[model samples]
Target: MRLIKTGFCSLVTAGSICGCTGPSAEKPASEKYNVLIFTVDDMRDYAGFLNGYAGKVYTPNMDRLAAQGVAFTNAHVTATVSCPSRNAFLTGLRPSTSGLYNNGQWWKAALPDIVTMPQYFKNNGYYSAGAGKVFHHTPGNNPPCSWDEFQDQVFDDPWYFQDWSPEKYWLDFGYRDPKVPMPDWKPLNGIPKIGNNDWGAIPGKEEKDYGDVQIVNFARDFLAKDHDKPFFLAMGTYRPHVPLHVPQKYFDMYPLDSIVLPVIKEDDLDDVPAEGKKLAMEGNNVFVKIKEYGKYKDALQAYLACITFADAQLGAVLDLLEKSKYADNTIVVFWSDHGWHHGTKQHWAKQTLWEECTRIPFIIKIPGAKYSDNICTRPVDMVNVFPTLVSLCGLPSMEGLDGHDMTPLLENPQAKWEYPAITEIKVGNVAVRTENWRYIHYFDGTEELYDKTTDPNDWYNLAGDEKYRDIIESHKKWIPASFAKPVPSKEKYYFDPGTYTYMDRKTGVMIDGRK
Candidate 1:
């Protein structure tokens, strides 16, 4: 197929869309290279290279990739939850700027005119395709702004799920309930019915049944296809989230007795303020279910098992890329939406501004990046993916993009840059992270500060200490004056536990905390 220029908005060369070819002068100038991006869900910085869980797990695949490219030690998601975090990442804006603070909100309300990162790629004539949890939901409801085509993006499909024992478990309590038998057909209400046990548990030995694996298969085949022009493939994996389901094979990697849990310290929550205490209390609802199964060790194992499972699945994609004919020109950027907290400070989810929730994994392998095989300790956010890829692809950069161009750091990991990263849990609860410290200020005037250089465990809060007063004050200067303003009471919020019969199992509680 011959590429042609249809209008000023698009240009096409005979065999290439962008028309820029190889380093050789003999090739055309407008040829474009393929772009491959893999975004994982609820994945924290647990790779072996980061020493996140140093003594416990070994992510050989991630470590190998990090050694080949820049592994950002301080990458954060603008928002701590799924919807808001993903919105900020794809839009190249902060959650505050995007107006998507929670899953209940809509992106249109946040940045109505926002031209998403993938949309720009599509505008440039790239064959954009996505599979598995790319957008917060499936197509037609709230599809992402970008992408010319989509594949296997089951907004609710259990991508990155785990298989185990004689049964496979759902990804989250919201996805299923062991209290009841599995439903013949999934309930089709606005909400889910986890309490009703609509999500029946199944055997986990079927390794190939996991959604992330299937998504990878699609991508590997896509990469090996015959295309006349460069392509943009974004494969999203939902793993290390919850319900911690994986195949028994992955689980067998670690002995049930050997699966170590993070020490709770028993008093980890004593230092947290009222605001944090309230958040932890709300998250406990999920834990109550875990306790019912007497699978506390199983649950903990499930998380670790899920991480290892996701890592292995990730290797499959990496393997395909390394062996592909387009390996030289294809750029790979692998990242997690956000982090999760398992009994950290007595919290079991990612709804707070703690390191387990805010700090995420960010890895990028730009083709022909000047300094390959480097480690970047500079702070960054998921929003950086947009501008970074745009500039790397030789497209006209978005003027004043909310995210900074990381090309320089990718080329030189030791490059000097002092960019501070901001992550939001609520309008009043915002955390600012820098090279040596993290400062979180609550709208209610409460604060928590941690010195990563000295207290990486976040065991101590320096907000009240006079010695660190100046440092806390300095970090405050970086916070924008704006505060979070949630949508008014008129809107509806939903967190369907699962679907059930005769009863509307998907119910939600609303609060107008406006004092």
Candidate 2:
């Protein structure tokens, strides 16, 4: 199987190819390298370089970064959802190990002692600062111990942040006042507004005022100043996620007429198992509604526009870093929480174990690594991120991490790696992805097998075929024998943010999770 390099040269005909062919820019040696991580929300592999989408994506900044860094071409997330995925990667623990299978459970309330990546860095004498939706976008999730200074996310959309009562929490599902000016094109494609499901250019909203832009501005300000010690700066972009509201200019980038819908077969779910079929039907049900309205192309255009807008925010910070004092010594890690689906396999949105949901564009830029502008085809997941950073920065080895250090692959893209990337949706539901195959096993003994080499769309499930028994066995070894019991949801405990204690809502008994 040939892997395409979605570098600037391959995507655009007129771009310079010098960055792809030359060595990375030389930087002076430093005692401790600063860390700069950009986490984008609901972004799939739709970079101009990754080509995750069938339509032409305009992401010059992502392409440029790929050309200057080592792009992990076959990277997958530990979990498919935002909360579990971020928790698994940041905490260096898989959902199976942490028992955090969904968005309702707060990690701080469930497992307080777990040292997150930022907290680990802060513990190791590094100054930590962050802004925007790094965690689950909940107020209580971002504890003070993780950072010396942090900025909360602020949205330009008027519908959001209008009310903030304890009952409403940070993200209230209730509707706002009818007088407020919401996106005129909401329920875009006439589909139901299931969980902020809308996208378009919000009139009178400037690009600079967008929530993601404000987050990047904070990072840029931090970059502009010289810190007393090496800093760990993390910035998150909330575009291309939901209510895909951006400036008019980004929407203009992808005209509705030029948008190409994802290629999906009518009978894609026929061969899937009961569990797989259930997940596919959930996605297909949404797609069916989208198709009934005859607005699939319009929806794609809005999603594509959001992706480009997010890319622009990414470019802004990258540009500032290049011009800043820490350009040489800072390590840049760009990743999305999970991938989004645009009518792939007759499915819409993420949460499925399929490629569109689990696969992501992961790039790590070590200033003076032996290899740059290279592609690593080995299967790696977000779980390796924490330990890999620890190894790269020469920090002491952390005990009890589920992932292995990926330093060898960073040093050499073709290094021998035996571990396959594993992604989980809930307890006992897992997807094991490798270079040539993806095997999924569900809690009820249902299974799905796809040969990535032949069928990238996973249109065919070969799990029922006896010929692939050995292949299934090989992938099955990677699955956990037992999963940890799920922790109680936030409703079970009344959390005191000041004390970081969880009290039983019914019993009124206080329990300190940090202990």
Candidate 3:
């Protein structure tokens, strides 16, 4: 491995303010390039470029990135949920390999030695810094060793600013500050507030006060400085995710009368298997409640508002990067952890094996690629992110990665690739996605098959048809015969967010944090 020695600076504190102390390395920009990863939360195919939404969506920043680089239209996630999906992609490991199947399982405890994508860059002579919801948005999930400088996720919710859990000491781990509450905006659309699923514009809050804006500021400050080494910066925005709350202007962008709801069929779940139906009915079931209150369109408006709000934040960062000195030498990768469902399949959130919860908008922009506006329809997943970045940045090759390198597809969008994207909800529940077909196999032996070429909405299931048995068998061969057992959840361990350590309840063994 090549060693590029450079100066160090502290970008996290106001005292240092990106102060560097040593001589710089004079390497060609083409020889070594910086990396910027912009990760959004729960963002689906609602962007204007993807054309997944029926109504018009405002996402110029996302569209600009797509035009500047390769857009993987058939990209999916390793796991549909936030925690496992983020963990699997960052580590380049599948759920079965990591044994992390849900949000409750602490990856720091389960896979302590697993090196994340940012850590790999940092280890290979790059200065890594990250902000916002890069991992699972938990305190201990993002260990110190993951980056040279890291910021935990900050929330702009009303509950975050209040002492809602003063009795529970574990919840008060210094992630958010207790301040005066904003004016009550709960149920802003006249719907009942189901936990944090509420959405509305804050009374006196500015766009600067939002946590995602603060995250963009973190990146802005870091990019304004002069770094000696090829830096790797991660800016993860938490929006279009939950609470769907933003400024009044964002909500005003979508009028209630003009807001368009998703094309959801009444009998969409009729052909779904028992396991698939059970997964759809899981979670908060906010769809049923929203429909009952007759505020379904209002809820969708909030979601779109949040998506536009997140896009604005992304546009700001992209603008800064464009004007910076590293603009011509930085490799940009933008992606979401997974897709989300609005009202499709009778589901309110993710954790299903359907296309609505699996397909995501993925774009990667290398500095000087051969082509622009490249759209790769080949099926790919989040696991390919780690290996692809490593290859693009000329970093040392990593071993034991479940995903294949997508460098060829970047060069030629229509490259011949046969690797199907595999997504897992839990251990045995997996979805195999190809260019035209999506095959799902549940843990109980029930299955679902959809032909994307004919039925893009996945309203029909042909898994039971004997005539298509060959197509089903072709996809079924990709599923692993055995899966690794799931790891113990956080509830089964005594977790200390301060030290980022976990003590197993049954074995009385301690799992140390990565730091």
Maximum-lDDT candidate: 3
Give lDDT: candidate 3, residue 276: 89
Models 1 onward score TM values of 0.79, 0.89, 0.89
Clash total of candidate 1: 30
Per-residue lDDT tens digits of candidate 2, residues 286-324? 567667878788778888888888899889999999999
Candidate 2: misplaced stretches above 4 Å?
A: 1-30, 156-195, 370-373, 496-502, 507-515
Give the clashing pairs for model 2.
6-49
Backbone atom clashes (below 3 Å) for every candidate: 30, 1, 0
Q: Sort by lDDT, best first.
A: 3, 2, 1
Quote the lDDT for 78 in model 3: 92
lDDT values, one for every candidate: 0.66, 0.79, 0.80
Backbone clashes in candidate 2 total 1
